[model samples]
Target: MEEETDTEEEKLLKRQRRERKELQAKIQGMKNAVPKNDKKRRKQLTEDVARLEAEMDERHQQEVEHLRLEISKQVEVESLANGIGKLECEDGEKTAQHSRPTKAQKRRDKKAALEKEREERIAEAEIENLSGVRHLENQKLGHVLAGRGLQIKQIPSDGHCMYRAVEDQLKERGSMLTLAQLRSQTAQYMQGHVDDFLPFLITPSTGDVYTPEEFEKYCDDIVNTPAWGGQLELRALSHILQTPIEVVQADSSPIVVGEEYSSKPVILVYMRHAYGLGEHYNSVEELKDRTTEIG
Candidate 1:
């Protein structure tokens, strides 16, 4: 009887343990099953925490860098800029009179002064004394035509003279012949006379001005050959002579550069009288009236 009782008790204990395990599993599953909406909320919270951490790290780094830079800037015995009177001089001239400005500020001030000075000087140009290249017969800017023709009063040979070509072309073509046309024709004729030029004068960079050999070689290239044709564009030549060159509108005599005035342009011949290389005048109107004599 006792054995049967003991077996019964064992069976009862097993059943209770199984029920406890099932109850525990049910409670765990209930806890794990979250609402669908809460999952997104938890994920957003995690992401926000991570982002805030990153921003805080970045802010800390920026603060550290700012402090370090401030310290370095404050530590300098010498200037950080180079443009104005330098912190250390090459000539070793020390100035006790001048108050020390930051290197950058000093440079900016110095630049402003220099630009102001240049403007003042340009503004103060003595137009009366300004003149063109001294042509023989002391050709003033206002010389009248006598049909005597241009001769090599200066430079190269009398035969290779450009002054005559200019005069001849000007007289026949009228004073309105564009500067570019004159440059082109002058080069074309000169190269025609000298047949040995190698590289053609299709593009006129500052390639051969100082040397005679390069000049002759280029002369033969562009102008010497009858096979090349009558004349490479004469107007192109005149435009090439002036660096930082300006052109005037056909309707107006206003000086125009890259963006000083209009952007759209019809490339016309450079009018020689347009630029006052021969004289000085502040305005184009001054150039027209006071600068040149029509007679």
Candidate 2:
């Protein structure tokens, strides 16, 4: 539907462009056709040129108005769709409360947990200026982590930060993993547990929820390309590694993937202002020992 609408809009725009060009050419021709000494003819030519210009301007204004209306209509549709989706989710949650031990119930629970984290567990919207960390603020957060016997291990600010951070965390625990392998594993995990991840899989670019097919392509991208990881990927990694992944931010409470008493040690990551200008990731860990001093 969106593609069809875009195609129609493009056709209209192309028609308008052609019309404007013709009007310009016609006006220029009329002006050039009149000789300087032919005053009466020149006056008539000028009027004709002005009339053509007026038509062009009117067409331009109409096109602009049409585009504005189209944009307004799209916004309304998107708003309505979002509202309906929210209501459906609410209704599903109400039903899930009384649901049996079926697959639907499990899906409902996963959806609820994921939505809660996406909406309320993290305060990521206000931390958009992630060009780099503020020294004073980073120091404060670091001190807090240090008090908890942890410190940040800086990772490269490249687009692969998230993958690198996860790899580093795994390596520290005696596993030599590469970013590519981790990405592949994460993609595989998400594919195998589609029901668990599907409800939470939204396209960041479109702000639309993903269909299973769309998600499959997303999984392929994760496996075949070096895409930056986000919350969904983090959760997928936790399942893939069978370890609880904990993400601690400066402002929000830590997000945990599994129970605190789980036998597998928790993997910790510290998110700084690491991803506004460009997305990146960093690992937070127990303080390193250097001559018995902590890093």
Most accurate candidate by lDDT: 2
lDDT of 2 by residue, 174-234 (tens): 9877998898889998888888777655453464678878989989988886555666777
**Model 1 over residues 191-262: C-alpha lDDT tens digits?**
554432222232223433225566555444434431111112222333333212233222334333223333
* Ten contiguous residues minimizing lDDT sum, candidate 1: 278-287
Cα TM-score of candidate 1: 0.20
Which ten residues in a row are the worst by lDDT in model 2? 122-131
Which ranges of candidate 1 are over 4 A from the true structure?
1-107, 126-128, 131-218, 221-295
Which candidate should be chosen as best, given TM-score against the real structure?
Answer: 2
- TM-score of every prediction relative to native: 0.20, 0.49
